[model samples]
Target: MTYHHLTIDELTMIANFRDQGVKAYRATKLLHRSLETVYRVYRFLAAGHTLQEYYQHYRENKAHCGRKAIQLPTDEVTYTKAKVAQGWTPDTIMGGHSAVVCGRFTAFSSGAILICGPCR
Candidate 1:
């Protein structure tokens, strides 16, 4: 979706609702805007300063949704054996072993190691 900049009027409305104790999600619905947009503008207007600070914080937080991608681990002997039996290439085996590892471990906790291996 295309993201338009929050106008001064929209920011004012968000701040008014927040000051009146309206929740962020509900306020977003009331404004007919995305949840993130409402949240960023609420924080921006409430900070009692320039909107740029709020935009910056929103961008930073939005980018902080964890690491981009993870690699598999080489120490997983079971995965290695399975790959060998399947006659898969090293790169293919490494990238495709995530589902098997996730079955044995939490997807995020073991994700990096399972995708790239311990070497990475």
Candidate 2:
């Protein structure tokens, strides 16, 4: 399974379980997590930290305001547009990747060859 960030509630639960004298194996069963996860939680608590502290640290480490816009490269755009005007479809412009061809065509329409690579 793909790893997901541990939730604030899960962290709280882990810390609370450890404080209640629950062993890591039993804690794992309760939390539906692996023993390693329980071990990490116990270690964190034993280090004199609280669940809130861990969650806050985690949030600060990964917090971002927003995603930056994706800009097409200038020369890539020019070349793609030129190729399109010369009767090349997005498929040909992309050199035959059907998935990429469809996405670019849908986004930019047929007239503009959307450059799919480095500006050259």
Per TM-score, the best of the predicted structures is: 2
**RMSD per prediction, one decimal?**
9.6, 7.2
For each candidate in the order shown, give its overall lDDT on alpha carbons.
0.63, 0.67
- Name the top lDDT candidate: 2
Give the per-residue Cα lDDT of candidate 2 at 37: 72
lDDT of 1: 0.63
lDDT of 2 by residue, 1-120 (tens): 566667888888887888788888998898788888779878877999877777777788657433433456666666766776798865676764332423564435534344232222
Clashes of each: 10, 1
User: Alpha-carbon error at 78 in model 1, in Å?
Assistant: 69
Error in Å for residue 85 of model 2: 15
TM-score of each: 0.37, 0.54
Cα miss at 84, model 1 (Å)? 70
lDDT of 2 at 104: 60
Summing lDDT over every window of 10 consecutive residues in candidate 1, give the lowest-scoring window.
Answer: 111-120
